[model samples]
Target: MDHRGGQVEGGTPDGESLPALLRSWRRRTNPRGIPGLATPGRRAEGLTQRDVARLTGVSERWYGALERGIEAEYSADFLDRLSSALQLSPAERRALYLKAVGRLPTLVLPPEAGMPEDVDEGLLQRFLDNQVPAPAFATDLAWNVIGHNEPLLEWFPWVTRQENQMRWVFLEPEAHEQLVNWEQDWARPFLGQLRYERARHPKNEALMRLERDILASSPAAREMWNRREVVEHSHGALRRLRLQCRRGQEVAVRIVALRPMRSDLLRVIVLMEDQRECGGA
Candidate 1:
């Protein structure tokens, strides 16, 4: 709350400041409100430094120092876990990192918001295109499908139709038909992954909107979300997919998801059909 140290650009463009942002996020969050955000004693209003420290496995005083914007050193791993506990999304994590470095997260803004896509998106597109005849697509940390190959559109054109991958999975009527084992293979794990994502970026407008919309529209989705399951990873595996575009078509494809080394938000997925094992004519 004390900007007397010097006003540094952070949070909102209106110069909301970092400590304010942290405190705001904390105040709005309750122990039972969001997943992984629950702290032991303070469910009445907001989380305390003690709660954050307890969650991050650090001392209360140490956590307080960072929260107060004191010149303190923090490990990436520690920051990551702390972000997870507070349910800080990719954008929030980046912003928090920036504040720690005496810089603002919005220091470099691409045309779009929350896109740390400083990597060569064109080159990545080329790589995705090279996987022709196979379904390949890339998604940001929030699970927004950023890029994809033409082949991928044949089956998952829905993914391209909409930006949010989780929304498409849950909201689309055709999802049940597209994914053979919709409940177990697709929906459950995907929901858990979304749970993790939601926890990380509790303040993301798009994500928050999608969550509200889904919860209101679908009872199933609401139940899954309320369960508050946290999945550390969302790697796709070999599975059967129904080619909705093709009549009487079911393909056994091994779907693999890989995150780029440059940023945690960027993820690439490639689908390989096991033609030999499945005896393709």
Candidate 2:
């Protein structure tokens, strides 16, 4: 199985087919292999074909045909069930399905040895320097404020109190009242990004701790987490935030994210508003 570049059409030098791989996987996932099932089966040691069929709601004969590669047409949904039955990781699942159809590609991540703890202060300063009129700050991949210019700190002092962005937004009462369109605008994407990150890096201790603290500290945060929405932070995404000034006037600010490098640790956010939009505040 030539597993290079997601192309898997012609068999390897040994003529190994995807069905061969499936069969091997099938042999490993018996009922006992799964966490809670009874292991009273007679012949096979691992999950029988019947166990997988029952768990995935597919006909035993149909699943058998699938395992045997006798069926040519297989839906992604069916492959998904098979993937779950085999307890394949997300990458493994994708690779298996792709191979089954003779395509070759796989996702690989860089080693996590040198990830930065926070965005660089110099980078944040440079970003803020370039955006003199706009407020800008650099945050970590998890949206924790790492560095912000005086202007941003002056405007959003609450950023200083909480390290986590979502925590500050939902836990702080002032954020709900100050941020216009809180639910429809920021909360949805913020929560979604958190969930997405959690799935991608389930073993991240900092992320897990942040989630636990937020869930315990704020009901709104818990509710949002329960919704299980997932999203990625995209560059140039437009966000609107309403800020209340000390003089009791409202200002509408447009927020944009700036990535100085491909690394997720540094994200500089710029806030801009038209002079007219500034109003009395």
Candidate 3:
């Protein structure tokens, strides 16, 4: 038991107890005033225990006890939710996970803000540009087509014309025609990614604009967004995209989104043809 006579949970908070840390951090985190929570809550500013419970998907009683430094244990998943609830840094989150579960979380988590000021030119352009035949491009967090190669532009004119992929996917009528399995393959996954990125960078003005623009264009997109789904999307399943071209050809390729180790906001998408489609690219 602690000097306060409360049962110690994982490890003694010592002079720096978990409950004390929670209480301190909770006051410092103002959800309503912050860029998080797309829609602000009715509860007063700063994170409440109830808010933590809801965000972490744990019972108020359970979260409260943990907050009070009582003996407790939770799964790694619970720690993930708890980390988000507390809006902790990756390091801080890791520490919390160890404190709660006596180990690191099974799932990998990106830092709250890991975007580099600039992605090295060689990595972004020089390398991807050489990836011939296979359509390749780079995008910012907003999914804006900041750079691309001749093959990608030649295959998809709409991509060249449009500045942002999200805008094209939802607003441009041609996107539905070009991307096969529109709802399942392209739209849903992209929607989930947008939601995930937004959660991490809610205050970013450019990102906020992107979200507003997307919502303004498509009700279907809005409905999906409201579902509040988030996914850990690095490189996703192989997808078949129907090129919006003269012949309307369809090709199966794995689309990969690569993030540089140091950068949070930069993403590179490369198209790879299936082995059967070899000699085609």
Candidate 4:
């Protein structure tokens, strides 16, 4: 029984209950690792509810109530504090938010974010190559073009030279002439996606560096970045491009962004001709 004479839920191996999981996590944390935490005269192993409450800036009773899965709607900030106090992993933090708030947190990126899984390089290259006439390329989380088909390299040779798609789009002078309606069709949306990715992986060094380079080098990029627009992806979006293959004629392409099951962090982008527009012409 707790101090309130209520029965404390003991965790099971399955640990489906919120209270049980919280208690289990609390017990697993090492007291010695936590800086300035007092361990003397402690009855239970790991951190006590009082310790967690103090760390999270809440009363012991309130923290206890949260652990008990009380039906109060917890704010995102409170849950964030609680997650930090418990030293929850990304997956664990997501689980805590889902259990407490009936949804995922806005800022919680999965553990796989920015980290690409190992895959057969030959197979991945073959997959891009199979796209044939369409421009197909694969990018890591930081928009670094890791792999591209012949068509992609032919159409946007800058990818081979620049390595990073974001850098080429935001910083390259040639991009303005190549991308039709550079400001509206490309820059704005691309900036939005970049902002979204940066928000997701705030600690990513390459992304931060790219952001600094673009904002510092290009006044247009600096202006667009400050617009505060955010986009997750450009999938199914119709984008126009002025390709040298077409003698500088503008062509409309439909963006198809796919995440391979084996490597969720690798984005496979294929620019397929917009059949609806093509058929109309």
The best candidate in terms of lDDT = 4
Query: Which digits, one per residue and each the tens of the lDDT, describe model 3 over residues 169-231?
Result: 889987888888888788888888888878888887567877888888799898888877787
Give the alpha carbon lDDT tens digit for every residue of 1-281 in model 4: 33221234544333466777788889987666777685677544688898899888889999999788775778887887877767775567767877666776665432233645365557778999999989899877877676789989889878645877887887788899999889998899988988888897888866786788888999998988888999889899888888887788778899999998876577899999887786664
The list of candidate 4 runs beyond 4 A from truth reads 1-115, 279-281
Model 4, position 158: C-alpha lDDT score: 83
TM-score of 2: 0.52
> Candidate 2, overall lDDT?
0.63
- Please report, in order, the local distance difference test score of every candidate based on alpha carbons: 0.69, 0.63, 0.70, 0.77
Number of the candidate with higher TM-score, 2 or 3: 3
Candidate 4, pairs of clashing residues: none
lDDT of 2 by residue, 1-281 (tens): 23322223344653445666666677776666465576465555566777778877889988776666553556666666677677663345546656665442221111131135343445446767777666777665556665667778777878655655667887788888777778767787788877877887788755676678778987777777778888877445444455555454566566676665556545677877745656534
What is the TM-score of each predicted model, taking all chains together?
0.56, 0.52, 0.56, 0.58
Worst 10 residues of 2 by lDDT: 105-114
The count of residue-pair clashes in candidate 2 stands at 9
Maximum-TM-score candidate: 4
lDDT per residue for candidate 1 within 1-281, as digits (tens), equals: 33322145355443656567677767665667655655576456877777778888999998877767676557766776677667664456667766665443331222232456476767788999999988898776666676789989887778635766777778888877888788777777777876676787777665576667777887888777667777756455767778867774888888778877766666788999888745762
Error of 4 at 3 (Å): 75
With a 3 Å backbone cut-off (N, CA, C), the pairs that clash in candidate 2 are: 5-104, 6-103, 6-104, 6-105, 7-104, 29-47, 30-46, 30-47, 31-47
